[model samples]
Target: MTDHPRSGAHDRLVTSLGTSIVTGELPPDSDVDPVALESQFGVSRTAVREALRVLSAKGLVGARPRRGTFVAPREQWALLDPDVLRWRFADRVDGVFLDELGEVRLTVEPTAARLAASRRTDRDLADLEDALAAMRSAGEKDADEQVTADLAFHDALLRAAHNELLLQMSVVIEVGLRLRDQFVHGALTTESADKHAEVLLAVRKQRPKAAETAMRALIEKSIADVEIAKKAI
Candidate 1:
């Protein structure tokens, strides 16, 4: 039931302009002249205005009296917004961005795992098991499958926590997983599965501290691997 952007002049303008802004082709504070955009995209002024409104809602652009539209500063951007995150991943994953994602994971995920240890339901466990099984079957050879499974595992973990705020973090977590998979070649390891297994065991045992520790260890290792990959790049 999601309203995907239609493949028309307005949607095309939105996507092209949003990507350009996010990727710094249109730097922050730069004026977004509506006439220029309309001419460039071969769209009407209304279409350009509509696209600008969408970007503004996502905190990617702002309008000033007599100044027209301008790209917003990085801090003003809605980084957690799903559309913005998708646009970001459309380009090469930046190391600084990855590090910021790692910091978020470290802050939120271990605590979520701890809560899951205390409150997980049978269905949650089933989902986690299914995700783990997918990971095992996919192994390192299937990057796409592995990333999907990896995302599912964390998604299940957050849902198991039963916190609405934590559940909301699933988008950011998925983006991080995709970025990791995209940048880190041959990154999946047996130890990764082992670490996830440890988390599952601790949660099943209702041991919050152990679950937190296991999740932290897994994320720490993932961040380390990403760091190594960044160096190689």
Candidate 2:
């Protein structure tokens, strides 16, 4: 646990450094000057050290016996950690990263949708409908709201699956989905509500095959949408 009194400073320092490392502002294997960090972030030495500890736990940095702490290789990063994923999505839109995220979604979501259709409870259905309603209400007029609602719909879908492992995986998946949604927000030429509705309809009807198919199509559209958005960027 961190010092309660210095929590704010600790958090700020961690955020700044984490974002820099993930965005390549502080590229892999670069030296990390803790004394410089204390000066730059205007935090106590203790706060700086504590922040470094947090990043270390996230696999963002490591110390050499003679050389002090340095940014770790990119492959060493805890990519599934929510904070790391958030930092990666904080700035810069990389098409390759988005494609990889889509591939992950393809691997996870269709199977989740199939299970949800087979096992969803009344409460799960209610939550999904509520999320879908919010999505419809937001439409294209409100990009931020649409993104939030879209995320909620997926979260509810995962919950509907009623599997502990998939639920755990949703933590990472949600972050990637938000990035994709935000990236394609204003650039999307087609209405996404209908596609989401198709998946919802299948789940509601307890059609596993249909739900799986609809989810696959939805994810495919998202992949294509990201590609289109990248071109506009």
lDDT of 1 at 192: 89
lDDT per residue (tens digit) for residues 89-120 in model 1: 78687778889999999999999999999999
Give the C-alpha miss distance for residue 90 in model 2, angstroms. Answer: 1.6
Q: Give stretches of model 2 more than 4 Å off.
A: 1-6, 187-190
TM-score for each predicted model, relative to the true structure: 0.94, 0.90
lDDT of 2: 0.87
Model 2 lDDT tens row, 141-190: 78787777888899999999999888877877777766776677663223
Clashing pairs in 1: none
lDDT of 1: 0.89
